[model samples]
Target chain A: MGVRIQMPLSLRERIGMEEMVEVEGDTVGRCLEDLTRKWPELKGELLDPNGRLLLRWTIYLNGRPPSSSEELEQYVSEGDIITLLPLVDGG
Target chain B: MEREIPGGYNGRILRVDLSRERIDQVDLDASLCRRLLGGAGFIAYFLLKELPQGTDPFGPENKLVFASGPLTGIPLGGCARHTVGAKSPLTGGIAKSEAGESWGPQLKRAGFDALIVEGRAHRPVYLWIHDGDAEIRDASSLWGKETRETQEKIREEVGEARASLAMIGPGGENLVRYACIMHGCFDAAGRGGLGAVMGSKNLKAVAVRGDRMPPLKDPQAVKRMAAWLKDHMDLVKAFSDYGTGSPMPRFEQVGNLPVRNFRDGGFPQVERITPQTIKGTIRVGMKGCFACPVQCKKEVEFREPYHVDRIYGGPEYETLAALGSACGIDDLKAISKGSERCNAYSIDTISTGMSIAFAMECFENGLLTLEDTGGLELRFGNAEAMLEMIERIARREGLGALLAEGTVRAAQRIGKGTEAYAMHVKGQELPMHEPRLSKALGLGYMVNPHGADHMDSMIDLFFSAFTAQPTVAVPDLIPLGMEPAPLDDIGPRKVALFKAFQAKRIVADSLVLCHFLPYSFSQVAEITSAVTGWETTPMEQIRVSERILTLCRLFNLREGITDEADRLPERFFYPTQDGPLAHRSLSPDEMERAKRYYYRLLGWDDRGVPTPERLEELGISELEG
Candidate 1:
């Protein structure tokens, strides 16, 4: 079973121009790890040096975000959807 | 023979006394240019020097200054910017706003670094400036016209098909306190009621056309920088592709988007009104300002439901949130139509949307009635009512008349508990940003001279997380010694960071650079040096920016806007009903401490007044009123 990861257009060019990709994992962190492993360049964009998700970018499991940082380790299921979005300052 | 001016300057300041129907030109002072640079700096200096204390904002004594910086018209990515300043009718303080397009560059090409207008005109008129001369022409026939027709008629009368113009609409003519001066079709000096000042002068437009470009000291260096920015298009591809509203969903996720008049925590229909949705639906094309490759401006056209003119341009993130989720209206077309109306009528979208939202909240809470709204159901999510209210406000009719006074005054006149719903600071309505999400930004909303402006400081979210081992998304800020901090931190460290970022933003405004561009402070200094042949550095620019800010503060203080007015509305002190920030709230004591700390950091006293020694150190002690 696999989860679908959606990327914003701003980072698409860095990840071979794909808008969404599917990866297999049991956890949100594992899914991101697999996705970043496939596109090594995205590792820096999605994670900080401590391997935590960058605060500037928010990860949503389905339509809502994870409640806290530890929620990254929360279990996922088949057909779960994850989305990445950047929190820019102004217009 | 003309006197020698420095490189990147035409060395002329055009002065016009509309009451006397006189026009004259003064030589730009090189020393003043060195000290203040231009744009916001020049505006601050002139307003502080010439404006008498307690001058009525709409009176003939109020002066309007339009200024361009040393970098203006330099054919760079974000150099086509300028500032307009006057005593604000809304906030009753120093009003300074910036706009970018071809107008500032055109003014530079027309052989003037700045244009100052004073006194009221006896009749309707417009200024026609071309090449190296300017003349006042009759605009009597163009009175009561909307912005598009006004621009077209002025261009035809001036006989310059491609001339750039800055003008106002019926909103200004009727003296709406928040009227904005629209530049070109879409770009606006869109805050602080500068347009009403122009209208008060009975001036309709200032149109300019010229072929001359300012001479740069190092054209090659400027070209190299421009090329470098173009080469780095990937850094701003999202903005280039989708414009500013592309991050609407993300803003909602982080509790940044103002929902349901800033009372609600979330909008389930946020995705329906974003720029991406507009691009897929009503957007016709994308455009950019002079010499800019980012092309963040959006163009939209539609004929169904309601016809939205492409000439008025499209709404950005502020407009989307202000007129959309803030009012609980997710219909993108209605919001687009509302944006068009604002651009056409020369009303400020932020204030106008916010005023309507305030009215909606009042109506929903039983503070206002159907009769009060002239038979319209002024409820949240009522798109038609929102649109109707915009027109009425522009015309100053019915409930629009009250809203046109802005929320603070409207709440006062309503005589109900509606004051709590008026989300404003120092009489100016808040922008679309929610302070509960970013605490430092909330502090900025309090202390900003013009009132609740989003662009006054760097947003806290940018500094909330590091993108790499040692830097945030804005790595340019690293040289300024800014380290990553949490979004909710408003400690001394955060206050210091805020001051540095505020100084940098003020420098950009004074330099008249675009905030959206990711230029480093060193890059900005290098460009300034290359253009003006001055040995500039990042620290020097920061000092100059600080000086400009202090001058603005002095102007505000002289006008009676003291430190007591530096506070957010009570709504911000409480948490939203639901959302990511539902459990979060701003403490008044903490914010008070942060403000005082910020003041002390800027060398100001506890009351937020600049010390005499600090003024002397900045070399502006004599200008103190």
Candidate 2:
């Protein structure tokens, strides 16, 4: 139920992330939480201090946004692609 | 500090009467510029006092005033933004303070504080100003030319290599309600149909080249402030290199953008049409206004050198948003093409794009068909279809005629439940900032005088990204008790203080300083002290800006949009359907609590009119006295 997560271009540059991060969690949110936990320094910039996700950019479960944060809890099948698209500002 | 000057201010207000074929220049009075800070401020005041009410927006009774602030010709931040004010053919208001650096610096260099244009012409004409000499010249040959061509022709005719020109294209000539005036082929006094005002007067362009620069107070101090701004290259680099279009990717990810007429927040192919797209396709150098260090403008040069990439001002965030996601066209090329079309026709790109998007939505809903659209299937993401509509609208041929009138009136004319789909505030198309995500921006838009503009108050952003208190404003009511709250963060007090601070900071841009630079307090103080030698502080400097705001507020009042107009659009109260803000809406009852508190903070009555005491205290519109 664990999958590899890829950091967004913006987040990668900010956190000096590797090509793909190894995360073990049942859901996308869980995976992200695990990723944040492993990359502790990346927490504030990616998630709000209260741990709520910053909505400024997009985080896709596979190729699109997951319906809910809880949707990440769904067991991740192998080869699922999670793309992080964090934009600094929206025009 | 009192230096005796010889002919510093070419203090003459030029008036062109096309119907009478007479041109006159009046002497500049100190009180005029003093009361209205010279640019949009002066124009707004003049329009309120001189132009008669109830006259048709297109009639000769209305006049157009193009002005630059005191810092225009100065070498400070290249902030020479001009103001164009008149009865809006689009919004039917007394003024829309639109500007571009080209018109302003040129006016100041031409040795004039401002240009006041009046009366409609019997035929086409353009104004030619060369170093204090201005005349109404025949523009019959350039009548049908686009903005760039007309400018080239005028420059050629005048035999001047470097001249700042303001011109309208086919859109304005056709009297499109949202027609804008273009300067430097990229910048525009874009909203409220000022170009149409110029067209109605039969004035095609205003070309100016001046030999002198305005005298600044305390040159040494000015230089120091300029140097401080110069050292902060990071801030300047943020805008200049990426241009404002850098936000496209973020907006897509955030779900704050309107993809296909507010139906969706993100575009499927948005990456293919962002600043990165341009970076990958062409070599673009940074561009800027005359005195601006932060050149958020882009100049892309194509190796093949097609007509499109020959080099022009880059489209900013608003243009990208309007022409891209708003219309469901994710192709950067088409968005750039639409921007080029706007420059050619001198129309507001935001309104034009929004109008077309609304039309497309209408088509999808079966309100418009191929027959109605001349056999074009107006579906979302059709770049060619978008191009066809823009060209047609600019030309005022076929369906273009109806769309040229702007989104609000067009929606009303079309009827069929399309009004709800037309995204506008107080009859003006909404600018970029999705208010649900950035509530402060939305509140700013709600209270903006030119109809729901975000620049009026943009603090919601700091709160969203930086501050601890997330959603704080009085939400529309004044003084639950007789006395207002303290100025601290206790309850509604912080909201009141924030509003006043925002108003002051924004209004200083009336002096034409780029808001990006953190130089307002120091340079504004130096300039004030140098000019009048008043011992000024940051707080006092803002009060001077507030004085100008008082006049603008009065103009809005005279234009018949009062405190009642200070409400946001209804759509914002309901949560959005796309993105993270889908379930969130700023409720009216909530807004009422905050706005009422704002009115009380400004010392206004329950109706939100500026109190007589407040007016006297702020020295509102002192010139009329």
> What total of clashing residue pairs does each candidate reach?
0, 25
**Which stretches in model 1 have alpha-carbon errors above 4 Å?**
A1-31, A35-89, B1-5, B466-474
Off by over 4 Å in 2: A1-47, A50-91, B1-10, B32-34, B301-311, B462-494, B520-523, B527-534, B620-625
DockQ per model, Cα: 0.20, 0.08
Per-residue alpha-carbon lDDT of candidate 2 for residues B1-625, written as tens digits (9 for 90 to 100): 2223212244667777778878787876665554445665676677767766566889988888887666665666746676777888877765565565567777878777778888887889888887878888889999989877887889989998688888899989989888988887887888888899988988899998887775665666667767877865543443555666554554565555667777665565667666656766753576677777877676655433224643446566788878888887877766777787788888888888888888898999998888889998888778788889888888887778888888778888889887877777667788767766654455566666577564455434333331232333221112221122321122365455456546544445555554555443455656545543345555554565566555656666666767777766566777665665666666677566666776676667777677788877866524332
The candidate maximizing TM-score is 1
lDDT score for residue A83 of model 1: 76
- Model 1, range B281-303, lDDT digits (tens) per residue? 89999998998988999999999
Which CAPRI quality tier does the interface of model 2 achieve?
incorrect
TM-score, candidate 1, is: 0.91
